[model samples]
Target: DAGITQSPRYKITETGRQVTLMCHQTWSHSYMFWYRQDLGHGLRLIYYSAAADITDKGEVPDGYVVSRSKTENFPLTLESATRSQTSVYFCASSTSGRLGYFGPGTRLTVT
Candidate 1:
């Protein structure tokens, strides 16, 4: 439960402003990912990284950016926050791409 925790638990930003959500995992799983949870949409992958410096786009990558410079850290950034981007974001880590351990989740609101 405490293996991963996201910062700023909640945030509110204006449209066109930039925002970044930070995720840190103490377990150091090889694969880390960013996902957004919204009403009706469920959870959608925004991006994922297999290892340090190796990242790939996921189901929804537009308007978002991610970087993994270290195995335990993966940060997701919104290039320009939009109303549609407001949602609860989660960070998860997995060793083999199957089961994953998730963070506490960060609630982001863009007005």
Candidate 2:
């Protein structure tokens, strides 16, 4: 309730369907990041926002979209979900981008 949290802890969606995963933080950190964890990739950054209206693409931003309208909210959307996108997604927040606090995570499976 006081830290970071993710909604819909688990999700199952069909290919080509649109899905949105929500991340909310109460700490009001300046930097928020979205990462996808896979077998070989470990933890890959999908997108990150330095501020409310300033966002940037990360290492693997191909199939994912992220937006930060408020300091406490950073939501990631899959415009057209794909099977290859199935992974455990984590939302993290940090003040200096060195050490971050992560949310519980959302496990998404695209079928």
Candidate 3:
């Protein structure tokens, strides 16, 4: 079965602008999370949603926001992109207490 998918596998941009990354999944997992992977930061949670319209701030939610209005979609938006924000973003979904399935991943670079 089709799993999660993320758009713009690679991106480049100048610092300070809005950027929204799209994530979609075919499996109706109830928990979706957004995380950024960095060289030293490992995987930092940016945001997550337990279900539609129910999101909570993660460990590193600053400058980032996410919403899950549909059970199969969770989108992440950077209010103002920055160079420090450049990192590999991943979208993951899972059933409660189960292993998460990750998307292909999106690499964003800001100058």
TM-score per model over all chains: 0.95, 0.96, 0.96
RMSD of each: 1.4, 1.0, 0.9
Candidate 1: C-alpha lDDT: 0.93
Q: Give lDDT tens digits, candidate 3, residues 1-111.
A: 689999989989878889999999999999999999999789998899999999999999999988888999999998899999989999999999889999999999999
Off by over 4 Å in 2: none
Clashing pairs in 3: none
| Candidate with better TM-score, 1 vs 2 | 2
Best by the lDDT measure: 2
lDDT of 2 by residue, 1-103 (tens): 5899999899999999999999999998999999999997899999999999899999999988888889999999999999999999999999993688999
Q: Model 2: which residue pairs collide?
A: none
Off by over 4 Å in 1: none
| Model 3 TM-score on a 0 to 1 scale | 0.96
lDDT of 1 at 90: 95
Off by over 4 Å in 3: none
Predicted candidate 1 versus true structure: per-residue lDDT over 1-111, tens digit per residue:
449889989999999999999999988799999999999999999999999999999999999998898999999999999999999999999899468999989999999
Worst 10 residues of 2 by lDDT: 92-101
The clash count of every prediction, one per candidate, is 0, 0, 0
The alpha-carbon lDDT assigned to residue 6 of candidate 3 equals 97
